[model samples]
Target: LTFNIGERPTFRRFSTPLNQKNLTPFSRHRDDTLNDEIQSIRSLLDRASSGGDRDRASALDRAEKKLRAAQGTRKSYKMETRLVPDPRQKQMFENKLKRLSEQLSQCANDMKALRGNQQRGELFVGARGDQTNVRGEMSGDEAGNMMINEMNDIQDKTKSSIMNTKNMVSASKQVGEATMEELLRQREQIRNIDDEVMRVDDNLNRADKLIQKLWQADGHGQVHTVLRVRQHAAARGRHHLHRDDEE
Candidate 1:
């Protein structure tokens, strides 16, 4: 049962060794032993379940180990040449081993499930006993006082949280009002700037029209345009001075 890569397939037939010649009879005996072990394990599981033995799980572990050993033996038997003439008989042995392994596995699973249930049952009983002990140790008045204290603590915490939330809301409202006032101030300033810009634009437009008229004028008309420009500038200065005085 050895192979080498990148080479032609060559198989060697090995004759049965003298000591191993009794493989067929030995395998048959092992099959019977495995069958009996399977039954024994089933009985052990039943007794353990009924009696609730503490060592039952460990016993199942040992049984599984033995089962694995038996399976290994069966594998070795399969590898070795057998004296049995019929292929069907060999297949029957293999099938029997398979069934036995499956039964053993089922028993192990049942034991695990039983152990889990037992542990859960013990925990449930322990919890109940602890509860009973605690109830017995404490007086009704004491228990009631403890509950009252816990309630008072919760109420105090709740009131404190409410107060903190109210303070936060008041602070947020003040912040919002201040922010709105500042925004209103900035809006008023922007409006004043726009009005000032519009007035300057109007003045620039009047000056541009006067310059165009002066450019198209004869000598006397040019002199008249200069006079009108000076009069306009003087009027604007007086208007600014009167506005400052009124302010």
Candidate 2:
């Protein structure tokens, strides 16, 4: 997967190898499709009624299928790439998947709660009908109390779902913060390395200059000694070594 930092992150269209004929073609639009399915499910959940159990169940099924497809696509993408993705991209993908999973869980919980309410409503209706025929079996007050109890149970579940969602959001936020901190730490390390390289370069330049100065001083000292020997030989009126040998 190609990660362009400047653009909005998107799952690009990728081609799989011919050897992997068994896998479905991963679409670039899969993310969009998954999001649409989730939104549809949410809408259905919102409009859920005692009588629309079938519709809710159907939406749930569709959502589950979409989630599975998304998961499969993720697996396929991982399998196709030889190179590991950038950490930031990987984290983004993981966070998105986590969010989708949480959404699915919430949808499931809502569906279950709605289903329970529908069942309780049916029971309440049946009990009332039976009470009309059977005397002193179940009072109207008892039926009302049963419904109130069911409502309270549903409320409790709803509260739990909300709390769970909040916790997940908080966790996701923490993970993102950690990732940013890690990136910042790595950047600092890189800057330190660059600074160290510059310092080493400066030291090397200074050492080179010192070596050049030493070499120049040694050459001048040798030349001065030779001049001194020549002057001494001239003062003593001595010939050169080669002229002495010829004589």
Candidate 3:
């Protein structure tokens, strides 16, 4: 912004280099925007996947595409907002995070149940495999026909079980991915809020601290919930798996 006679004019706006501290609060708007986009995309995807309509499935695919785009945006925003020292926002961003996290946690549990069902189907196939093997050793004509029939039946059931597993895995992965996205956003939001609190009021001791603590605690609880569900599903699947082996 300095102009001297017989000298080139220089723009001070571009003269000074941008630093981390200066860019911190400016990047938060993008974070908020991306967080909203992710929530909407997830909701749409959820609704699209529901109902008995094949059309809904296609819509769900579209929603997934949007969610991916939003995630890309969020990634860039996170990189831009790294360890921002000061945040100008309040504690208002927590509610959206809490809702998204809880909803995704429920979705995770549902996926766990689906996984259990898939395992049960696998056990069914395993049992059939044993039965077919035993019948194949028989030399009698009746046993031969029975073994052939059992083999065909096993093939059909095995295909069904495999398909079920694929579908369940797909669903679980979709939900798991969405959950991770929301969790990351929530953590960033919390970090920014905490940083803001420390910068603005170093000596503050208030009920808001408890509130933030609860929010963090709830996030941990959601993770634990997902882990517990997976553990339970694995244990039940193992039980059924062992029972099939014994029989």
Candidate 4:
């Protein structure tokens, strides 16, 4: 098998040795062993087929079909390798990054607008209170004086409330800006991760396609070999099969 990250490919070989001591769940016969191996491979391909990774799934499906056909022929083959991204894919990724950048800019503008509105509201409240207080001092009876004092206190409290409100708004604006910046940063990080994931997915798809081509070129003779080896190993110790690759 060959695995690649970016431009470099690492080739690795796998082999299974057969032993006579243990009978596998399929059967003792070579054909049965081959069937079991094919089934296992099919299961892996099935899982890889069903998910968010369309390219990977398609590649796996192609490999499975090729392997199945090879099983009918009972021969050995080699898979072909292809480079991923195919130009159009690279363009799509670039476009997505550009869109994300635009969204981040829009988010910054919205935060600024919110802060401006908050500032304006505080100023309006402050000016209203000041007008009321100035009007209160002009009337002069004793009751009016008391009323004026009360009005003065109210005006002072109103002024203090307006100042507090302005402070709160300023603090909120700072917090909002910080939050927006953080979110933008996080979004960019996610975009970068997605880009990496897309590249990895492309590589995996290419690997899968290569493996399929190899299986088709050879035939299914490798199935018996792998199963026979697995059975032989199971005799020495209990071997667990992976239900899902996540394990």
Which candidate tops lDDT? Answer: 1
lDDT at position 84, candidate 4 = 16
True-structure lDDT of candidate 4: 0.47
What are the Cα lDDT values of the candidates?
0.65, 0.59, 0.56, 0.47
| Residue-wise C-alpha lDDT for candidate 1, range 118-142, written one tens digit per residue | 5544444444454543432343344
lDDT of 4 at 116: 50
Question: Model 3 — TM-score against the truth?
Answer: 0.31
On residues 1-247, what C-alpha lDDT tens digit does candidate 4 reach at each position? 5766785777765453333223221122333334454555545444443432333335455555545553442321110001112356335434433443353344334434433533443344445464553322222243345456668889999999999999999999999999999999888866766665566566556655655665677767864554555456444332222221122
- Ten residues in sequence with the least summed lDDT for candidate 3: 134-143
Off by over 4 Å in 4: 1-147, 215-247
After TM-score superposition, the amount by which residue 98's alpha carbon in candidate 4 deviates from its true location, in angstroms, is 95
Candidate 3: segments with Cα more than 4 A from true spot: 1-25, 83-247
Query: Which stretches of model 1 miss by more than 4 angstroms?
Result: 1-20, 53-86, 130-247
Q: Which of 1 and 2 is the better model by TM-score?
A: 1
Each prediction's TM-score versus the true structure: 0.39, 0.34, 0.31, 0.29
User: Which lDDT tens digits does candidate 3 get at residues 1-247?
Assistant: 7998999998866544567555545455655766676567657655544532343445455655665666566556555555454453222233333444455445445434444533443444445555544322232343446557778988999999999999999999999999999999888866765565564343234334544565577876665665555566556655654554454
Which candidate gets the maximum TM-score versus the true structure?
1
lDDT of 2 by residue, 72-109 (tens): 65454444332323455455545665676677667767
